[model samples]
Target: MTKDTPPPPANTEQMNSPSFKLAVQDRDFLLSEPMRGVRFMLEYSKAQILLQRAKIRSTIVVFGSARFREGGPNKEPFWYEEARRFGRIASQLGGALCAEGGNHYHVIATGGGPGAMEAACRGAREVGAPAIGFNITLPHEQQPNPYTTPELTFNFHYFAMRKMHLAMRTKALVVFPGGFGTMDELFEILTLRQTGKVQSLPIVLFDEGYWREIVNFDALVKHGVIDSADLALFRFADRAETAWEALIEQGLDVSVGENDEDLARDM
Candidate 1:
């Protein structure tokens, strides 16, 4: 091999092969079906790391319809404004606005889409508080709302992992009117509570009339599908402040700006 001839191009084909690409750098390899488990882990770990970095200790999850609008049909605007109010009130009183001891508590969390999610995040934004948006990729619902803190917003491909992240750190759950997806989430949480799968969570369903008309709790008890005592798993509220008061009465620890031993222990 002469120095001027460059050794016959040094067999560039081998180096350029797809298999020679680093595993982490190989998008096709990482996205393949065989790496699904790895993708799940990546989804889980990425959010976990970002949340930890933000010092978000707990969250108040708000689930509601993504279809509602400020001036659309029915009481859409009312519900939207109430959700916004709830977000603002909760952030102000629930320790989200205060990062005491390097930890933020009961920060607002939502599905990271339109309607109620947007309202809640907007409220947090209006109050200058950080909120979380756990967005899932879908053909109809990929764009995240504009209000969630950019650093704290996350995207996931797996619905199970998204649900896990939503459920894990929630201190309280406030659900507004929604369709099938929202119902699925609400029931799963109720089932988890019914089966003692998780710690006690304060659940408040907004709009008592709407929910009662939608799902007859009395009928369920009459049919013996669910125990009558199970009815106590969640309460109903018609207004935003009432919902906040209900959560407080239901044992949500609104003790803000405290680095108490109990809070630390829970952390």
Candidate 2:
């Protein structure tokens, strides 16, 4: 040996350097706050691709509490059963079973957690209809229910993206008794409708007494904050079939991809 040459280092600094890692494979780099916009886009694009491939032309989104159980406390069982029945009814009559031009309509969509979501997904599966479960990452650990179609089941990191997906294809909305999360979703749709951000969507709140007691739309009208005409934004229903009828009366077309609106907005 000439003894003039220095031995190579024990480790390859180039291989271990963050700069050497591919940007796509660098989790830390992707998750950094500076990359928030990229993360949002990633979440949006992934769900969009899957939904487009599934041919989910429109949806009858069901919102309710994950805490309400089949045989839980009083009225909770009724709410669960009603949500399940509503899911079945929507799938059966909303043209989800019959696709037109390869597009499915009125497919049941849920928050993809338990309680009413599980019940609704269960009902759709029983009818051999595909159901979408938009599960979210939560502090308490939310998991997708077994009843949602495996291919259609999706987990979302951003609530905004999840809500956008939920709103995008929705032809009608049916909300059962719920707590804070449920109210948030309900109010979100209401605000969109109020501001004309979305198409005129038929909204049905199950359990008329409960919804009336919880949210005083009448009070909002009385206070002059919202016009009395805004009261027509949503209707109260006491039964699953009633909700379906309200949706139909409000112009819920059971056809495929026929809405005058664009099927999916690029934004």
Q: Per-candidate RMSD vs. true structure?
A: 2.5, 2.9
Report residue 172 deviation for candidate 1 (angstroms). Answer: 0.5
Q: lDDT score, residue 259, model 2?
A: 62
Q: Count the backbone clashes (under 3 Å) in each candidate.
A: 0, 0
* TM-score on alpha carbons, each prediction: 0.92, 0.92
lDDT of 1: 0.90
- Tens digit per residue, CA lDDT, model 2, 207-239: 989988988888988999999988889998998
Candidate 1: tens digits of C-alpha lDDT, residues 79-159: 999999999999888888863446788999999999999999998888878989999999766799999999988998899
Candidate 2 residue pairs in clash (backbone atoms < 3 Å) = none
Error of 2 at 244 (Å): 0.4
Which segments of model 1 are wrong by more than 4 Å? 1-10, 99-101, 257-267
Estimate every model's Cα lDDT from 0 to 1: 0.90, 0.88
Give Cα distance to truth, residue 21, candidate 1, Å.
0.9
Model 1 lDDT, residue 60, Cα: 95
